[model samples]
Target: MAGQAAQIEGIVVKSTGSWYTVFDPATGQRSRCRIRGVFRLRGSRTTNPVTVGDRVKAEIGADEGDNVITEILPRTNYIIRRASNLSKESHIIAANIDTAYLVATLDRPPTSTEFIDRFLVTAEAYHIPSVILLNKMDLFAGPEFREIIDELAGTYRNAGYEVLEISAKTGMGIDELRARMQNKTSLFTGNSGVGKSTLINAIEPGLDLKTGAISDYHHKGKHTTTFSEIFPLTGGGMLIDTPGIKGFGLVDIAPDELARYFPDLFRLAPHCQYYNCTHTHEPNCAVTAAVAAGEIAGSRYVSYLKMLEDDDKDGKYRK
Candidate 1:
């Protein structure tokens, strides 16, 4: 059957622009494949047509080195953000993730609430489970810093999210992270300098993914993990590692729907005076009242407003 096209099914483990590394399900063989010219992501304006964690069908010829990916199977879910180059378009980070672990840090390039909230909103929009991983806990040496970290952790945990305080350098709480990732395809994402790669190495040693130091001058993480790649966790799961994100602009979501993604806000939305309250200037707004009454975190309310600002007609936060 040399003349017959050798069709095979596999999952895309790595995406480096034009070439994709797909792993064979049956034989565990990896084939470097290129997308067929006519294939495109349906209803998507993303830069890359395919991303890591996507199941695909490819035709392997006599030389498996140059297989052509013919089709992408239906994805259960995918996480995306605004592409850096294209303002209107987006970039799919990873697909079919059972859980998205957001790695955050309190010092040496601290993670902001706006970034965390935007990410959580996106995850909420896609119905993907999100877990917050607070790395660099060892840096919380002083009682003041420890209080800040503990308060931040409490804020999220109260919002119905699972927050794990970890220090990859010291292996603190890495085991718990591993246990949570067991038998699940988890997407590890975070801002630069938040220790995403270091945590991965700690979770599964020898991978030694190239990691860079946080720039002391700028206090930001230097870009590492240039492309999206998936690694099989020794604990019977998959972890997709993504490049450090500087910003996570929401895409494919509308302004009116933003409040619904915030669980705490949504719960109080129905009690507002106006049925179509924007929660900004609307009188007797339950959301704002909750924010004032100390029932909701003021930082979260600010994040919601920032997203709303981006959705404004002349909003400048789109990027």
Candidate 2:
């Protein structure tokens, strides 16, 4: 009942816990409606249950000019994060996205490579194409942060990804990013201070989302986006901007298969003798050998090991 993507009627554009803003296809109108009572108490959904991109059937009240969510449609693919609760359920981030943008900053409020790796691994596991967006190019002060950005871009690109360096302040690479968004759904995500809002304004300026400045004293961004919102791009496709995430715990991967998601690591995994090698202590392990030979970025490898450790401790529940 909860996971099916019903193609019978409308699209869910907004989710506010108790209600969903749905765009009806027949009448070409949008309305806010609560989920059926049975659907709410079903408790099958982990986080708010229905995400913003869900397509569902809405039955309008006879001559009442309103509707209620009757049935949810099945999803082709859904992006999920570990739920923030003791129960440890899976929280769906969004459904049916074309690509996921992990917007990052090189200097101020530096996004740890560990954070980036976790998000990337999760995307890989879910078969989602992901791109790393290096934002705030105008603020690159010196060789250190600049070199770091270059290294990050090279690391991901070598691992077979598209990386775009942009400056929300100077309007540098927004065109390249927008060209990719043409006629496809995209999810813009990053740490709190990486200027996600600023970049969105520069790209489509009409949305005018509340942009927050990072606190100079602490180098942290204030929470400007309270909830995940879906906005239509100029011609086609959609952009779902989610609240800044402090940590991303992958929900459903095993320790043995952890190396498979890291594209760099998986490339070398075939040489290992044991098909199920964990790489921590496996003899003749190709993954470890690549690590020693500098074939893979050390930071990404470290993140992989940490995810294995977490999987051992918490099983499939996202922390």
Candidate 3:
């Protein structure tokens, strides 16, 4: 047996860089540990070597100090993104997520539609069921605000997803959200300042996740929650709250295959000509035609193309 694999069995509840905080279920002890060098890089394109929600076997040191993670069990599914260093590599966000909650805000943070679409496409690529939660319903006091919410909720629902408008401040729609989350390990993700931490605090008060305000100058958000950490919900399931991600760099997905991630694009791509249409300039391209005829959102096709171009001509992602 490897020297590192001789200790305890536990689930990784937190991951920062290569350091993981694993909880030993048997003893209920959480130890901060580093993974074996074998797992470092090891051909993973992501910036992070390990991810939250990993099932790992940890070995506590002789002094009962910091432990070392010896092995990582297989994950059912994981969400990954491009590394932030602009190296064209990837980073594993979270693993073994039963469901993902796409939290967005209309008033304070104003989550972009392109961001939501890109995330949804990525979720589809990972085979994760995602539900959109438009937070801060209490702040949308005007009719115009309500109309936009309805339209967004309707758009996602029409795309074969479940969307709900909730007020983490006023407790609106929190019950339904809680019901759906019962007994499920859910991952909450969105742009910064979209009230992700606030909503989690409202739902599971004991979590006490740090929350930050949206930047008024850049009209963006600042990172409040640092590192990804999984918290056990008092109601039953687990919720993983990740740091506010400013950019969601997609990883590994090739350009030619990018359309497959978009449900609407995939549904209509088979009709294009040339059997392997790149959908750029190919004649009789159903995707291009759809774009021209307003069948597909131009923004989405552009985002797909961006992903493809970012993949480089080598047909792989690695900066």
C-alpha TM-score for every candidate: 0.94, 0.89, 0.88
Candidate 2 contains a number of clashing pairs equal to 6
lDDT of each: 0.87, 0.79, 0.79
lDDT, residue 31, candidate 3: 88
Candidate 3 per-residue lDDT, tens place, 74-98, comes to 9899998764426677778899999
Which residue segments of model 2 deviate by more than 4 Å?
Answer: 1-8, 41-45, 62-66, 83-87, 313-319
Which one wins by TM-score: 1 or 3? 1
lDDT, residue 8, model 1: 87
Question: Which parts of model 1 have CA positions greater than 4 angstroms off?
Answer: 1-4, 41-44, 84-86, 314-319
RMSD of 1: 2.7
Q: How much lDDT does candidate 2 score?
A: 0.79
Q: Give the TM-score of candidate 2.
A: 0.89
Best candidate per TM-score, number? Answer: 1
For model 1, residues 1-319, the per-residue Cα lDDT tens digits are: 5656778899999999888999997999999998876666464577787889999999887776558998989999999888431388788899999999999988688889999999999999998999999888888866878778778988898788999888999999988888888889999999977888898899988899889998978888988778889989995998888899988889878888899999988889999999988788878999899999988899999999887876777653342
